[model samples]
Target: MPDTPGDAHQSLRDLVYVQLRERIIEGEYPAGRRLVERELAETMNVSRVPVREAMQRLEQEGFLTVQARRGAVVAEFGPAEAEHFFAVRESLEALAAQLAAQHATPAGLKSLERILTRTRKAAEAGRLRETVSLNADFHRAIVELSGNPLLQDMMAPLDGRLRRLFRLTSGPESTSPMCTEHEQLLAAIRSRDPQAAADLARRHVAGTRAFALSALGS
Candidate 1:
């Protein structure tokens, strides 16, 4: 059902949203870049209505800042915002690792393995965008394995921002270390070592934060 044709009918606004968001996150539309509805509409070969809707949604999601006459510009997060985001990630991801270690079933572990395998392959193939998405999914799989609905909901929004940050800084070397850490973290979870898993998760998040902050010039 999820892959059905009915489910594939993404609206023009949704399509515009995805393209614009990707551009912003990838720095194709860098910080403070003005988002002109007419220009975007013409470039995307779409109507202004969808581009306007996409801009509104992106503004609400902190990817764009709308002004009275200046229209919308790409949003920029300063050091404080970066620090706050990383702190939130550190705590919640640690909790996720702990819960996953304590609650992961055989099937869940298998799913995590699948995600990790795909992630490694994407990284090795030089698919940075795919690797970023898979990296988020890999983390999401572990968080979902925690068997906590609230925790899953809490992580959903954060994953997008995490992807943007990860894509900005993570290169080939970063991918290898990240994959190695994920492998060791999965091993800890499989062994049911809650403390080890949680510690490793926190460390991973901290490392990402450090890289993100440095890359942002914060």
Candidate 2:
């Protein structure tokens, strides 16, 4: 069957959703910044219909909040929200690390090692953004290595929020410490020590939570 207008717009909607989500997560569209449908449509050379659909999807994902006056504004993370996020994150991360230790194969371990190698290089090069992105990749990789489809499914939705949180806490001073913690966690997984891996994961999340809360003045 020939593609209809709806089919075309669906593809455009996904593209717009991805682009807007990336911008929001990267802090280009800071919290409280209103996103105008018409403006974005014009900028991206797309129709308002697709832009609107993309915004609605982002809103469902907690990256944007729509209001009567504000239309769509980037979501903010306050103390309460931060606490709730960290609570869930710590649990999931600990579980992922433990499972990864139990299930990781030699190939899976090597994949994580590659991510760590790139992360270390990025940190050493003083590439803050790349380092932060690699940090998120490392965590996601560990989750994948858990070998449980259910656990992977659970972590999927939080990818964007996790990246945002990482961006918030990342800095020149953070790169080294983050690299060290990741290295230790990976080593635990390599050693097939589920308890050690889980403990390291919990501590890692706890450390990031404290830093995020302190920076947020929470």
Q: Top lDDT: which candidate number?
A: 2
| Candidate 1, 67-130: lDDT as tens digits | 7788799877656668988989999999999999999999999999999999999989989878
Residue 163 miss distance in model 2 (angstroms): 1.0
Please state every model's RMSD to the true fold in angstroms. Answer: 3.5, 2.0
What tens digits encode model 2's per-residue C-alpha lDDT throughout 1-218?
22997777778888999999999989899989999999999999998988998999999888999888778899997667789898999999999999999999999999999999999999999998999899999999999999999999989879889898878767788889899999999999999999999999999999988888887773
Q: Rate the local accuracy (lDDT) of all candidates.
A: 0.87, 0.91
Q: Return the TM-score for each candidate structure.
A: 0.83, 0.93
Model 1 alpha-carbon miss at residue 108, Å: 2.3
Candidate 1: worst 10 consecutive residues by lDDT?
1-10
Q: Residue 109 lDDT in model 1?
A: 99
Residue 185 Cα positional deviation in candidate 1, in Å, after optimal superposition: 1.4
